[model samples]
Target: MSDIPQERRVVTAIPGPKSQELQQRRVAAVAAGVGSTLPVFTARVDRGIIEDVDGNRLIDFGSGIAVTSVGASAEAVVRRASAQLQDFTHTCFMVTPYEGYVAVAEALAELTPGDHAKKSALFNSGAEAVENAVKIARAYTKRTAVVVFDHGYHGRTNLTMGMTAKNMPYKHGFGPFAPEVYRVPVAYGYRWPTGAENAGPEAAAQAIDTITKQVGAENVAAIVIEPVLGEGGFIEPAKGFLPEIVKFANDNGIVFVADEIQSGFCRTGQWFACEDEGIVPDLITTAKGIAGGLPLAAVTGRAEIMDAAHAGGLGGTYGGNPVACAGALGAIETMKELDLNAKAKEIEATMKARLTAMQEKFAVIGDIRGRGAMIAIELVKDPATKEPHPEAAAALAKACHAEGVLVLTCGTYGNVLRFLPPLVIGQDLLNEGLDVIENAFAAL
Candidate 1:
C-alpha cells in the first residue's frame, strides 16, 4: 500500500449505521420539539471539519452557524478550558466573582469599537445579549418604544421576538410579544423596491425619515440593527447608509445599537462590522464566535448608557461562567497571536474570487455580497426579474452535501447561500468546498 493515510467509509450511507440508530433512540428518549440542523451525528471535530460516528469527514463551511471562528476544538481554547475545569466550575459570578470573568470583560472593554469608556455584561447566547441591550436602551433613554428593521432577528425570548422582524419560525404562535416594539424596512439592496441599484444613502435617509415621522422619535429608545444582517441573508447596508443612520440616532437621542452577534469577533475581517464604516454604536451585542465553541455572549457599550440599569438588574446565574470565560480569554489571545483579523481578510479575498467566478458562470446567482469572510450568494429564477429560487438553493445544498461538502442556505425567501467557513480553514479545503458548490451549480 502507498504511504498515504487510509481514507475509510465503512457504512453504506451518509449517517452510516450508528447515527441512524442514535436518531431512533433520540426520538424515543427525548422531546420531538428538539431539533438539529443536519442529520449527521457528530463524533469528533477539529479545525474546519467534523467527523460523524460512522467516520465520515465533512468540511464545515457553516462553522456551527458562525460560532467557532478559530475552528472547532481549537488547541488554545481546549487547553485553557481544560485547565480551568481542573480549578473549579461554577461559583455564579453574582455570588462569587472570579478573575476569569473580569479578564473577559476587560478584554471586551478594550477590544470593542470606540474610544469612549465602556462596560460589558456577559450572557449565554446572542438572544440574551439582545434582550439586555434593549433593557439598557430603554432605561437610558427613558423611553418605551424600540425600533427594529425588517429582516432583523433578535432572539426567541418574548421581548426579543417582539423586536425581531421574522414571524414564521421565530415568532409564529409565540404570540402576545412584548409591547412597544416596532419594525422598519432594512437597507436591503438585493430587493430594493424602487429598482435602484446601490441605493444605500437614499434608502437610509428614507427609512430614518419614515420611522421618525411615524413613531415620533421622542418615544423611541433605540434603533437596533445588525452591522451585517446574519440570518436575514448576510445583507450589508449600502455604503453611506450606516453613517447616516448613526447620525440620525444621535440627533434623535435614540440609542444606536449594533447587533454584532454574527458579524463581530473578526468574522467580517474587522473586529466588528460597524468599524468598516467608522460607525460606533451606543450599544453593541456580540456572541456566536466570542468563546470559540462555548456559549457566551456580551453587551458592550458606552459606560453611561450601560449603567442606566439598576446595579442588580443585569446578570444571570451562569452569566459569566468561569469555563466559558477561560475559553474566551484563550480565544482572544489566539486571535491576536495568530492575527486572525488579517486571516479573516485573506479568507474574504479567497471567497470573493471564487464566488465571483461562480456567479459569472451560474445564471442562478443573482447577487454576490458580504464583508470579509461572511459572504453570501442570492439565488434567483431570472436575473431580470430577481425572483427568488428557493428550490434551486435546496437542490444545490443537497448536491454539494452528496459531493462531500456542507453548505447552508438562508434569507427570508430561503434562496441565499451563505458561507461562514472558519477563519482557520485551510486554503486547500476552502477551495475544495467551493469546487463542490461550482459543480453542483453547473449540474443545476
Candidate 2:
C-alpha cells in the first residue's frame, strides 16, 4: 500500500560513500554534543523503511525515537501539513491565535485520560511541556518539591535535567540542577532485588515512605513519572505500582503527572500507557508521537489546576506553530483511521513471539519486556548472574546497522535493545528485521 518498498536492500556499506562524506561535513558543522545512533544519513523515509544517502534501504526499527508512529509520510499528515504551509506558516499563536492550535488542544483534552473538565497548553518540545507542568503544579499547590522515580528521564532543560535520572550523557557536568526534585525507586520487574511478585508493593512502599518521611508529602507539589519508563529503559512499572502511587498522590493532594512523551499516542497499543492500568493522571505531558515528526508538545490537566497560572504565565513565541498543529491533527486522524493502536498490539505479538523464541536460543537475553510496539530486550553477560552486557548490546546494534537494519539501545546500564517500529510496517518486513536480529544473536 505504501510507496516505499518493504525490504532491506544494502547496495553499499552501512555508512556508504556518500554518507561518509556527509558525516565528515557534519563533524565540522554540527556541535559535538549532538549525537546520532547510526552513522548513515537518511535520504528519505516512508512507512517502514529509510533510504540512506548511498541508496541502501534500512528497516526502521527506531521510528526516529518513536516520533513517527503514523509513519514519516502518512497521507493525512502530508496533505494537511502541506495545505497549512501554503495558507500561513507562522503568525505566532500567543500574538494571534489560530484554529489549528486550539483544535490540537481540544483534541488532547478529549483524548487524554479522564472525562473531567480538562484544559491544555501547547509547547514546542517535551522538555518545555514538562517544565511548564512543574510550574503549574507549584503555582497551584504552593509547594516546591517534586518526586520522580529511579531511572526516570524527564528532559534536558534546566529543571528537567534535575528530574532526569541518568548521568553520563544527560547530566554528567550539568551541575546545580533545579533544587527540590526528589528521586525514588521504580518497580523495574526484571531487575527487582526481591523478585517480580514482591516488586510492586515493595517499591511502592519505599516510594511512599520516602515521600512521607524525607520529602514530606505536604511539601511536594507533584509526583511525576512515566507509566512505562522511557529513555531510562522501556521498563514498564510492575502491576499495582502505579495505582498505589496514584492513591498516595491523591491523599496528599499532590499533582500526579504522567510523562507520556515516548509511550503515548498509539505506540503502546493505547492512546496513553496510563490507560493500561486505569490510572488517570492529573497532568499529562505529551510529545514525540503527538505531531507526526513535527515538534509539538502539550500539557493537559484538570481545568482548575491548568487555569491556576496567571493569564500571561504560559505561552512561547513558537509554542503552537500552525504547521505543527496541523500535523498533529492529521496524525490523530491517521491513528484513528488506520487503528494504529490495534496495529501496535499486533506488532507486539509478532515481535514478542520472535524475540521470545530468540531468547530460548540466546542465553545472553536476560529479559524481554514492554508492550505493543514499544518493546525491548535486556542483555546480560550471564543469565545466572544477570550482569549487564552493554558491550553485547552495542555489538548487536552495530551488527543490525551493518546489515541495513536500524536499531537503538538504551537503559541506565546501556544494555537494552529497544524496538519502536512504525505501526504501518508490513508483517513481512517486520519478520525480516527479526530474522536479522536473530542471525546477529546466533553469530554472537
Which candidate number would show the highest TM-score if scored against the true structure? 2
CA RMSD (A), model 1: 2.7
Question: Per-residue lDDT for 91-183 in model 2, tens only?
Answer: 998788989999998999999999999999999999999999999999999999999999999999989999999998999898889999999
- What's the lDDT for residue 347 in model 1? 85
Off by over 4 Å in 2: none
Q: Candidate 1 regions off by >4 Å?
A: 1-12, 195-198
**Ten-residue stretch with the least lDDT total in model 2:** 1-10
TM-scores of the candidates in the order shown: 0.96, 0.99
Q: Please state the error at residue 415 of candidate 1 in Å.
A: 0.5
Residue-level lDDT tens digits of model 1 in 263-369:
99989989999999899899999989899989999999999999999989999999989999999988888888888889889988988998888888888999999
Q: How many clashes show up per model?
A: 0, 0
